[model samples]
Target: MNAPRGTGPYVDAHHHVWDLSARDQDWLAGAALAPLRRNFTLADLAPEARAAGVGATVLVQTVTVADETPEFLALAADSDLVAGVVGRTDLTRPDVADTLARLRELPGGRRLVGIRHQVQGERDPEWLLRPDVRRGLAAVADAGLAHDLVVLPHQLPSCARAAADHPGLTFVLDHLGKPPIASGVLEPWASAVRALAARPNTVCKLSGMVTEADHAQWTVDDLRPYADTVLHAFGPERLMFGSDWPVSLLAAPYGAVLDAAELLTRSLGADAHAEVFAGTARRVYGLPGG
Candidate 1:
């Protein structure tokens, strides 16, 4: 069962935690990302989550390495704030199912609700549709887990096609396909979003938008068109909220991110507000006591 509907008690559908000593995050490169080069722990996030009324969260993958997922699952096992985890794995590997099974048997394994590959970083936009990747996605379905799409706008068509190819697996689209809100453009993105949402097997996370916008001067109005596009197309029930956390710190504080999401969804009415903020995450991730 999904979480109960309401105006509060939110579920953050996406966030990440990392320790540099634990493992190197090769993606945290460049001078612009200096703020995130340090370790971000659950201890650092707990108070922030509590302050924002984030009752639970889905800990997402930061790198393509296998060590990160088990590390995240172990973290989830010890913390109540993390209700589920979307970990990483080599989706193209022949023993992908065995790897998932091994992950499930790890310390924090039961909390493993989904799998995500950094498809956006892949040079090929059609990476998700590759036969090996599709077979791995099918194995994820056989294991009863959801798959997350962390692709860019240009890669969304392939994501949609992959979702169609693997009807039994639920595809969770992270960050609204990473829209170009900073540029105020919404074409190819909107149309591609519609294509992905057309599949019942797909859902989207209303996350990472603040970072995508002009961080220093972003307004809720600037974020509206993109949010409304997903809200109206996928509806609140198919969309879940995610803070993107320390990554969001590059743009706004945690509270500001939640405030912006609330502002955008104010017209969704009470029930829908609850679904977008918490219910959808609970349903899709199968968090316990939902």
Candidate 2:
């Protein structure tokens, strides 16, 4: 049998890069997000990732535009840093499977590991359970791609149900379902998370806490309870680290995000740390190299 995989290199399982000159990020129109209105490229992230010891990254989708996935795939094809991409496609369309197939035929198509929709923007909390959405999820599973869930706490039950319905598809919960860190409330979110974790096919990203918290006044202790809850619920094997990058810049710098993640998991043993920082992402995303 093969030996256990040691902590080879950290994998940033989630993050985003965008160019404003090419297209408008409608989400950035608000003044609160004005700081991120400027373009952020892989070039901007490379040094910060390297300094943080992150060797590979999964560049995630920002907008729901059809062209964005191909752009991300091409970016991954060109960059040594971006190992995989979780891109966007309209899940309600009848041609989604074909679209996924077409995307795989693009420049960096092979680097496409998963699909994501801005579920948080949906008015319906049970959007994932919609028949058309469920059909799209089946297509994603058939394509051997995971689905990234970027939903809020109340929507997590739908996430759990989606995971249950599509056992073949891996449901990666981004930002631990975006917990209420700022308010310091854990109840329904924690309970919903535990329920989702019980589904076995689900995974959670240990990222985005800083922004979820009161950006300026947040402390590690403030995040500890939530972190501990996921650690207990999903365990390190099902949890991966992410920087959330320039978006995370709203609250803290890249190094600080990585530092916080390191501190949060410091109590874990080396093997568990290996899983959270690297192995889980590698296995979950089918990323190449360490």
Candidate 3:
């Protein structure tokens, strides 16, 4: 084993923080994700992550509601470990640019580094290609923050088209298009992922894949193919490790997840390992301490 050094100073590119008391994450209350229905605060995450040596975290928005991002920004401001916020903004909104501007003025709004729309939940494979949606994404790019894509495997083609359309924007793909690892299918998902990775402006996050598999029976090896596919497609420089935190709890513990990623990258040269484990996230998200 490479036995890579500590996780401190590594930029955990994707994670989430939420409070059930503040608003209902209805999706989590459903059977598939009921375990995460309760509140998951920064305080709850910090200690567990700290044990893994994680210095800073990027708090991603879990809901599409307008208030969710602002709430996350406030949480980032209050927490020392939260170095950035990848908040959500309705890109299809007529005033997306203005909305992002407004977001910048909130408590930890200045920590805002990117915007993400839960395109995966929309279910329309071409959802990202809608003209108005593209316009909003363009605005997000035109503004300066990176655009994080959360989409399903079948949507990768449209995502590629969107990435091509907005070369000026930095695109971060969440969960490697969330390949169907549990079923052992790979062709289309693998091919599409490679195509998306071909875009110089795009990057991929190695996260959330466990839950996509058999959440109750997944093992590190079950996640290996998806991870291996993404590593080959995006390479170490464009790839980054993300814990996906509270949400990942449904499948594995934080430390175990971190260890899996570490083990996967063990054979890489020191510099390449650093890039995947930390460097890439720092540059892609403009994280501090780079």
Model 1 agreement with the true structure over 1-290: per-residue lDDT tens digits: 11233456789999998899978888888987899999999999999888778889999999877678988999999999899999988988999999999999999899999999988989998998898998899899999999999999999999989998999999999999999999999999999999999999999999999999998899888999999999988998899999999899999888888888888887777888989998899999898756
lDDT of 3 by residue, 1-290 (tens): 22456435677788987777878887775687878888888888888888787888888888878888888888888888888899888777899999999999888888899999888888688998898898898888877899898898888999899889889988999988889988988888999999999999999998887777787888767888888989998899999989999888988888877887887777788888888878888888888876
Candidate 1 collision pairs: none
**What digit string (tens of lDDT, one per residue) describes model 2 on residues 1-290?**
11133355689999999998898999987888989999999999999888777899999999978889999999999999999999989999999999999999999999999999999999999999999999999999999999999999999999999999999999999999999999999999999999999999999999999999998888888999999999999999999998888899999889888878878888889989999999899999998864
Question: Whole-model lDDT, candidate 1?
Answer: 0.90
Deviation of model 2 at 262, angstroms: 0.8
TM-score of each: 0.96, 0.96, 0.95
Shift of residue 208 alpha carbon in model 2, Å = 0.6
**Model 2 bad stretches (over 4 Å):** 1-8
Model 2 weakest 10-residue run by lDDT: 1-10
CA lDDT of each prediction against the hidden true structure: 0.90, 0.91, 0.85
